[model samples]
Target chain A: MRIGKRSSKLMMNLYQRNKFKIRATTSNPRQGLLVATFLILVVIGADVFMDGAIRSRIRPMLVPVASFGRSAVAAVAGQDFWSSRQALLNENESLRERIEKMEAQNAGFEALRDDYEALQKMMAVTDEEGEKGLIAPIASSFRASPYGTFIIGAGFTKGVREGDIVLSEGGFVLGAVSEVNAKSSLVRMVFAPGQKTEVVSGSTGFTISGRGGGNASAEVPREAALAEGAPVRASIYEGRPIGIIGNIESASSSAYAEIHVVFPINLNTVRYVYIVPGNE
Target chain B: MSNMRLLLAILGIVFVFIAPPWLTAMCILALSLRWRAWEVLLIGACADILWFPGTFSYGIPVVTLFSLVVLIILEPLRNELLVDRRMI
Candidate 1:
């Protein structure tokens, strides 16, 4: 259906009026707020999605940012660690000096005690082992497989040899050298497997075999007059207390009396040992 | 179009595929140079779809419809803001 010219002119005027109204409404505050909110939401979503894509290449640009944060934290922590290390070193040095002083005093006391023991053993007058002799200091340790041994400072260089029994500075029977090198020899401790000896407690004077006992104590016959807190000496060429009896086993036909002796010296911790090279 | 604007638009499209971030500043610049907003945005969306085909291809119709609606709202305000800043 065709409209007349007058009607067509009226419709065109109305269309133009609507267009102008639309343009004017676009600038209203309400419309501006809606547009601004929509732009913000779109930009945020777009940025979130785009950030992932850009990050693959933008990593370098972000490095200085992350490093700035890390370095600040590290600087604070590093200062604390440096000060703590300095304080620790000062305490360690002071303790070391104190330890050295104590060790020197201990050496002098050890010498005097050894002399007193020698004099006591001398006056006993039983005289079963032989003449007493001064024990010399051990110099070095020997390490080998299947057989653990140590070397003394005094060897054939000072007339020590194979088959000679070595003693600790306290006159404890440690071991005898199974093999000898020029300046050092291998000492097999008496408690080593396959080694045995006769031992006597104080004045009991009965011979007991030195079957190997581990780091724990040894078990001896309970009714055989052994008691707690008694010194046990080994009878091998000379009498020396290698271990002390700590406890006696409960009396039962099934068990030998057991005692825990603190090893006369810590075998693993010993830095120096002695060898008594006698008239050989 | 002048050689400089055409070169810039081409460079802008290539970089959008190579790296989509190149589109944002470029679109703002293209608008500043008096290029039609639709032309700049159409070019940008097309280049963007090349890199992210899964999201933008099947997704293009939606984005296009949305972008046109946004462009219609934004064109007048952007024009006013730029004019206010003496950038026009």
Candidate 2:
């Protein structure tokens, strides 16, 4: 009789286990969804409630991952590595052509610079020794940041500090350092949304309102002598350029012409940046 | 979960760090269509955490805000269209 009772109990336990598994798998997704929704809301609230301490700690931990991703992207963009010989050969050929084109462009730019210098001399503008700093490799994708910021591999250990000016290879202002970690620093673009910079295109001076995503716009009097491809400069950087005029929108009746300025180099293809270290 | 869905979900997080914002948004939207993948919120939060830099300075974080919007928008469709009519 005892042996019979034991066998019956085992059968009961097996049935209950199977029923539990069924219930668990087919459980209402709505409950899970609602819970997740609540949890995410709570996370956001905590982020705000705690004064962003939640993000401050969590973000720094992601530096290694961001660094790795940036390295991978840079390598892919340059097409510098491949296991296949055919792929390597193709990359070599493309790089050679690219170098030739760049060399010609560089020569043309030199002549333009000479002409610009002569014009500046004629105008009696004084030459000044501009700010200089170290060149740092960009450690994050430029467009990935929703905040109009990007990461650079150099940081405090490398003399990078907050408010350092970030520039493209061509010496156009790109951004300034906003946050610095030991090995990486975050740079907020000059044209970040809600920011404005005073720039001069020819003799006309105006404020360019940042539209984010690497562009800014300004409005000048229709007769300000603004034209497409005109270089824009800010007096704060001495003679270094900020960006170039991209598109101009004006009509015969309008009193103001809309001028769009953009970085000469595509931010995505940029791999390295020159930093002019900040005071604090 | 199927392999493609799993891969897409994983890539969604990685792309937040390296891919363009629009592409990351697409990845998040695609995953939200299939499952109420709460990972969407995670990836969104990831972006805000990585790039936001400071508190409320740049306004409310857009990536996280957009991810939340994506998940909420797709919830009803997932419930209506899945083969099982609810989730497995």
Candidate 3:
């Protein structure tokens, strides 16, 4: 009993020696917020103080953990939990998703076909015309970055380079490669927050700025005829529809109306993305 | 470590990779209030390092920077708010 009390006192003494005073009866000190701040400082210090040597050295080890986290999430999603009703609901949801994906992809292919035909009549064909780009598995969390960026499993070794256009499974424009590493690359979303792209809404052309999380918004003259669910096509994405118009807001005092656009596919469900060589 | 702090720390780490940014931020915030949870910064750093594009990219290490700022801001506030409990 005495030993236990003495050890408790000793432990109490140890905690009391820190810089920040905690309200212990014996006057122990606070350790401060250590977990997030300490590691964050280490990462920042590695970048600023050590020229990123520590992060570069330690990143490879952490990659697997990130991958495992992704896989674990996938596995959990794939589970049925022994509930037949839930399973059926999931199946029905997936089927509806597949149909929407197919319809959107078909529309994209028809647009591409028309564009190709027009180009064929205008100029000689290049060698890379029909070459399909590489598919890379998503390595990091889409929810992880505040900058609307994500990492792909394939990188420099897989022929991925900066400025490569990334595409969804249904050929929707996703983003472009911003950074390439040995076995991983970073993709900055076309609809990244504050990013801009020229898009056509019906017959009207205007600039849309990304609001992040697979959404964007643009202002059009209140006199223009536009509707919700109309596809917005961007020239940078090979004239493909980048997103569909979602919501419209107009005020009596405003000259222009606001339209919020949404990327058709939910980024969370995407497991892989295709990388295409960007045109110079 | 206090059991509450330990559990909060574990959740903060787990949420960084799987949960939404807001959710993870909330978890970290809850953690910072209970204990001087430095581990939240590590989780934030790990997240920033993994997702942040290299020096060539346009992204800011937002998680780390935000957590640092939060910790700094909450330090005095927590001390003052929890003064009654500190008497124990």
Candidate 4:
């Protein structure tokens, strides 16, 4: 009661002090609107041009906060105790088989790497010919985003940079880093609406534009020998396969065929990605 | 009632990072219905800073733009409503 009385008194005192000015502004809504408009415009301008620098400074602080939220959610989910022992045993067995397969694949990859290095030396290509990679856990998903983007818990300090290529665990192209801060980065997925990329159709060498989302469409000539399930390769990576042709449609009247390409990786479930440091 | 509204607004700002955008939008709208809540603009700016990519990808700051629109459209309605109640 005492606090309420003091607050009312303080409010009355403030109102009395600014009574005339407040009345003038309230009576003339146009003047108030004009001032508000000007201020908003100034803010928007600053945000558009200077947002990167601001995020770069602020994201480091947000990283720990985001990590805490993630950990809390994980802990809550981990407390589920309804699964049977048999189910757990089956899952463990499957994991062991998967690990064995991965070990064999790793051995093959080592051999391939050695052969590639020899070829590179023969061609006089240096080790610095390509960018290095940094792995980062995804801090957030697109649940809050209207656009196709997610935040990764790695940033400038971890060698993540704007325009760096983001790839899945299997080296499939996922997206490119659009914004980089001190401790986090925003990756714009290849499947984002309105995003486009150049791709070459398998063997045909026909260069076409690929759109975003799990499925991308390209215009091919009706006479082109493109078929469904054919591989589509990224032009920038010199024919590194990124997607497969899902469908080919052509109208009898039109000279061009509409080809839809599908990405191999399920983009939604990706929890971590590798950031290949380079200019996009 | 005012305190409750202020508390909700503060929660809305924090929820920008942890909750869906629509929830945050709903919170801001609820606050606007009671008062001008000009701080919603700042909340929107913070959201943009935390989540929005640069203008190279998206042209405008969406949350701030929506908040400004709400303020512009709602301010006069609030004033007229208050005056009508006073007259009654």
**What fraction of the true interface does each of the listed models get right, in terms of native contacts kept?**
0.00, 0.60, 0.61, 0.24
Root-mean-square deviation of Cα positions for candidate 4 versus the true structure, in angstroms: 10.5
- Per-residue lDDT of candidate 3, residues A1-280 (tens digit): 9999999999888877542333542344343434435545655866866545555555666667777888777656645445687656776777869976996787678657755553442222122334657767788777766667777888789899888888775567788887677787778887888889999978989899997899898899988888899888888777866788898999989999999989988888776676778863
lDDT of 3: 0.72
- Candidate 2 lDDT over B1-88, as tens digits, reads 6686689878988988887777888888888888767778888888888888656765797888888898888767776785344243
DockQ of each: 0.01, 0.51, 0.49, 0.26
Off by over 4 Å in 4: A1-43, A47-51, A73-131, A201-232, A236-263, B1-11, B29-35, B55-58, B76-88
Which stretches in model 1 have alpha-carbon errors above 4 Å? A1-148, A202-219, A251-255, A260-262, A278-280, B1-88
lDDT of 3 at B77: 66
Give the Cα error of residue A253 in candidate 2, in Å: 4.1
**For candidate 2, lDDT tens digit of each residue in A129-174?**
2434776777777777767888888888988887887777666788
Once superposed on the true structure, which residue ranges of model 2 sit more than 4 Å away at CA?
Answer: A1-28, A80-132, A235-240, A278-280, B86-88
What's the lDDT of the predicted structure labeled candidate 4? 0.66
Docking class of 2: medium
Q: Which stretches of candidate 3 lie over 4 Å from their true place?
A: A1-42, A45-59, A82-129, B56-59, B83-88
lDDT tens digits, residue span A214-260, model 1: 22345566666766667777666466676676666676665566655
The number of the candidate with the highest TM-score is 2
TM-score of 3: 0.72
How well is each residue in A89-108 modelled by candidate 4, as lDDT tens digits?
67677786997699678857
iRMS values for every prediction: 29.3, 2.8, 3.5, 4.7
lDDT of each: 0.48, 0.77, 0.72, 0.66
